[model samples]
Target: MKNVDIDLNLLVALDVLLAEGSVTAAAQRLGLSISAMSRTLARLRAATGDPLLVRAGRGMVPTPRAEELREHVHILTRDAQAVLRPQMNKLDVDALDLTFTIRVSEAFMAFLSAVVVAAVSKTAPGVCLRFAPKPDKDAGPLRDGVIDLEIGVIGTTAPEIRTRFLFNDRLVGLVRTGHWLLAAGDVIRPETYAACYHIAVSKDGNTVGPIDAALHALGLERLIKVVVPGFPDAMRIARQSDLVALVPQSCVGNHQTPDHDAMSGLASFDLPVVIPDFKISAMWHPRRDADPAHKWLRDTVMDICRAAYLQR
Candidate 1:
């Protein structure tokens, strides 16, 4: 049978025609003209490779093949109707047993993971959030369904990818306690900052960034002594040595958290150079936009991140 080309509308028509056993009756039921119904029946027969209906005296009767298909076709048509029906897809959070993978930067993940897990555990106990390091801003994972969400500064991505602003993040300087730059005070002058050796954070290991450009604009530059793949690594290196780490505010843990206490020896100061704050966003593929469970997960994360920012 050449049924590969058959569409949902054709399946629906087949169900009605098989049940009614009359072309005129089926046409009226489907709100189509008698001639249009006849044409549809012809197409269905051609596609099914069967004489689905034939005249018996003055009325029509279903063939053996049609009788066999009638029940299955009706069930399929009804299921299609239910799936395409316009209604709120209500989700039972407690019953959901799906694991969603989120691609995120190590810095943000460090601060966000515990709180996000706590929240999700309280509400949807069965759901799991797997955090994967984002090596770069590649939208391929979301497109291929390898990841359900992405959290980071949104950059060049597919135009169709959906993004929502989570919070604004600004660059901050991290230095070890009693560092020479902070010997005078918490505020370091541009020249003093420029004199210090720096640790640059780049997932792809590119050394120069916004801070470099800002410094060069004033004919001042900081020597980048080391390049790290993540902000956490930069923070660690900064804590143990005199090398300065420049990181986003989001990378700093909440003041109330033990994570923050762990960084008590490292002081965070505003950058002497002017670097504009960038928006950290939640990005996902459009295919999951209207999915109830996915929407719940997005909203949950958005709310948590917003509250976390407020606390910071």
Candidate 2:
């Protein structure tokens, strides 16, 4: 048998043909005339020495050889796209209307929503953002391109996923403005912190955390009267009662206005214990790592988060 040399366009055409399963539909997908698509399919059949697709009823089905080659075609097309995308450096953000889906926890959304929305609108008037609740640290959405980005700690990630650090976040104590803890001193001591009734926030529903460990080191433990999944809920409960909640400072934000930014009802203070700060990262599939529009969005988010952290 003789060898056949294939190019990127040929691979893309085959991929589309196999996906659409009809010469007319594939032609539509590739924006080609029916005659041009037929000729291309005829060329493909001759090059591969197989009837790449055949009629099975009123529609076409991929032949066995085509079936076997389908995945290879997809991978090659994606690789070619990734290889060539870096050459595309020009991006008209305001002219392109695209929707980016990002997954994050409730705290992250509350912390960065106002800033991200304002920046994106001011720069990319046509682009929109759709936020999905991050129920877990699953990497499936990023790998499969189901979501554009995932914002969280880089605890673990698939090798193919690309990640960039957004900021380093530390936990702080939150309480209502008139809470008794505020009246104690400028900085609440570990004993003072542990003495108050506490509201613990954990996504995994575990009541124990690093704060608890630090308190235990001092031979003391706080009374955790509540366990909840979200920082906002914890704030709500703490504000209404005498409990103090430890949460990320990033979650407490100000509503922006022309005059000044107004802080939310929740107030934050540094934790008495020395808990390590966790890193927040923006993760995406490598296939989109080099695309100009995607690159802009990623950098934009990193900038917003950095500014927010600086302000706090």
CA lDDT, every model vs. true structure = 0.84, 0.79
Q: Estimate each model's TM-score.
A: 0.69, 0.69
User: RMSD in Å for candidate 2, one decimal?
Assistant: 8.9
In model 2, the Cα lDDT at residue 246 comes to 82
Model 2: per-residue Cα lDDT over 1-312, one tens digit each: 556566547777887888788999999756799999999999888777899999988988888998899878777776776576445458877786777888886757876777788899999999988888888777876765558988987755578788888877778788877878889778888888898989988778788988889989999898988999887789788767788888775666522321022234556788888989888888898878767888899999988877766454
Instruction: Estimate candidate 1's alpha-carbon lDDT, on a 0 to 1 scale.
Output: 0.84
What are the per-residue Cα lDDT tens digits for candidate 1 across 1-312? 333654668998998898789999999766799999999999998888898999999999999999999879877876786587444567888877877899886757877877889999999999988888787788877875658999988974499999999887788899998888888976678988999999987766678888889999989998889998878889889999999999777677644442665476798888998888888899999878887888999999999988888565
How many pairs of residues collide in each model? 0, 0
Model 2: worst 10 consecutive residues (lDDT sum):
254-263
Scored against the true structure, residue 100 in model 1 reaches a CA lDDT of 87
